[model samples]
Target: MSTIFGIPTPALYGQILIGLINGSFYALLSLGLAVIFGLLRVINFAHGAQYMLGAFVAYLLLNYLGINYWLALIVAPLVVGAVAVVIERTMLSRLYGVDHLYGLLLTFGLALILEGAFRHWFGAAGQPYAAPSQLSGGVNLGFMFLPIYRGWVVVASLVICIGTWLLIEKTQLGAYLRAATENATLVQAFGVNVPLLLTLTYGLGAALAAFAGVLAAPIYQVSPLMGTNLIIVVFAVVVVGGMGSILGAIITGYVLGILEGLTKVFYPEASSIVIFVIMAIVLLVRPAGLFGREE
Candidate 1:
């Protein structure tokens, strides 16, 4: 068996693959966060709950409605996104123009409520979610055995990340969104419904979180607390990437994931806190974040 630095080659590759898988989730979650904070200026503390909601929505659709994984993937995000829209319009919109802390507190409370309700109803145990049949198998990549679903996850996440980047950076609607954030009064005077745009942006952020949850369901058990496990790490990713930086969030997530994976291979004890350490360093060195513009 060939070894790299005394570590088995297969083990090394396996960890790297695992790292990529984790990075995919991080990218998706942070991307949503960046979108919300970047455009809406809302801290959106409830993002984790929204992710959990997505998994539950998928789970419920499958168990009750006989909807398959593929269908649930489409339906879950829509359902969660709609709920987010309603929340934004009826509740979040009121907090606009106030301190960002107020919005954070509000969403934090909502997250607690949602998490508590789900935990009360469905215990703390994780519920299993099966992968689609088409992606159930595995493939050999010479040195490692790769699960099709895992590969799909990485590919899908990359595509989604790139697509979102293009949407915000290249599209006309994206330009309007950027414009509205910069000068809502001007955009509104020019006939754009700024409020509507804000609502939609919040909804889109929630939808991205939901989509990530659906992808995560099969890998991690569907549980009320599942989102809690990942939310902090993702927040760190967003911070390190530069809060509200779309491209920065995307790049930082994957890089941090890979770094964490390598840490596990070398110094296992530091794996859990490595990302946080990096976040602290970034905060001290560049408070605006890696991609955030200096004010």
Candidate 2:
């Protein structure tokens, strides 16, 4: 039996797969945070609440109505996006002219309110969501058995992440977004409808968070507090990755996730602090992040 680093190679590969899945979620969630920070200049504290909302929405859709997992994946994000847009159009829009602190506080309040509401109703208990029929099984790979759903998650998220990166890095639309972030008034003078753009950006960010939420629902319980903890870890990912570039954020997320998973295999005690420790090092070595340009 061959082994790597004193651990069985098979077990190492299995943990790597799990790491990839976790990394996928990290990538999606951090991408949203990066986009929001880049375009809006606001640290959206309500992002976690939106994540929780996505899981709950999918859960309710199944139990209350006849909505299945396939449709819920599409619907959950849209619904969460709509909510974000509404918040942007109403309350968030008013803060653009105010201090960034105000925006952060407002969003934090919203997060607490939403989380409290969900807890009040759901009683802090979690509900289970079944995996879709198409992705509920596993495949034998001779060396190991691969869970179909887990592989699907890793592949699907990778596609989505790469697709988003390409859209932002290569498209004309993304150019406008980048330009508007620097000088919104100038962009608006050209009749680009900057307000609409902001709303749409928030929607996209919320949709990203919701997508991660839906992906996780089948694996984890659909509980109000789920997002609370997840978002903190994701925030560390964003800090380490820097909120400057989409590609940077996505790449950093997956890498850090894998590192954390590997640490758990070798030294379980360090798994939790590894991310924060990396964050501290990144800040000291390159305050602008690996892919970020110095301001």
Candidate 3:
């Protein structure tokens, strides 16, 4: 068999595919975080709980009502988004003018409540969410066997990420969002409904996290604690990507995911800590992060 760097091509390709698949999740989750941070300046510690909620919602929908995955995909996000909207309208909104730390503390409390409730109800066991019938197979690529679902994940995530970026960077609505973040008081004076914008932005970020959870349901065990582990890693991703730049978060998330995957193949022990090491290096070199702008 052909080899690159003395590693079998199939083995190398397989690892790369794993990298890309993981990167897709990182990109989607971080994209949501970036959006909220860009607009509201909230750290959104509850993002992972929302993700776990998405998975649980999907599972509950399936088990209790015989609803399918596709329906859950849409419904779960809407439900989580609504919850997020309520959060913003009630608590987050009032904290907007206060110190950013308050928003963090409030959300962290909310996250604990949500996670505890889920664990109380569901216990620690993870439930399964089978892949949709259409995507439950693999294709033989020249170098290695490729899982269609995994490839589809990479393609779909890239499209979603780019589409979101364009919506925020190129569209008229995006222009308004960008403008609002810079000068909400001025934007409000201009009669743009800044309050509504803030509510919608938070909902959008929560919905994005839920969407990511749906995407991940089949690949990972659907469990209450799942989001807790990933959310911490994503924060690191945000720190490296530059909390100020939306595009930077997306790029750093995916790059780090792939790098982690590659490290798994070459040095399994380092895979766990590689992201933290990169975070340290980046912090030492560029305190604001690669895409972050100093205040």
Write candidate 1's Cα lDDT for 1-295 as tens digits.
9999988988888888888889998999999988898767888889999999999999999999999989988899999999999999999999997998899899999999999999999999999999999999999988899999999999999999999999999999999998887888899999998889999999999999999999999999999998877898998888888875788899998999988888888788999999999999999999988988875
Task: Give the per-residue lDDT digits (tens) of candidate 3, residues 1-295.
Answer: 8987888878878888888888888899999999998889999999999999888889999899999989998999999999999999999999988999999999999999999999999898888899889988998876689888887778878988999999999998899899998988898898898889989999999998998888888889899999989999998998898888888989998999999999988899998889999999999999999999997
Deviation of model 3 at 183, angstroms: 0.9
Per-residue CA lDDT of model 2 for 156-175, tens digit only, reads 78988898788777888787
- Clashing residue pairs found in predicted model 2: none
Clashes of 3: 0
The worst-scoring run of ten residues by lDDT in candidate 3 lies at 141-150
Q: How accurate is candidate 2 locally (lDDT)?
A: 0.88
The model with the greatest lDDT is 1
lDDT of 2 at 32: 89
TM-score of each: 0.98, 0.96, 0.97
Which whole-number lDDT from 0 to 100 does residue 239 have in model 1? Answer: 81
If both were scored by lDDT, which would come out higher, candidate 2 or candidate 3? 3
**What lDDT score goes with residue 275 in model 1?**
97
TM-score of 3: 0.97
Ranking by lDDT: 1, 3, 2
Q: Model 2 off-target regions past 4 Å? A: none
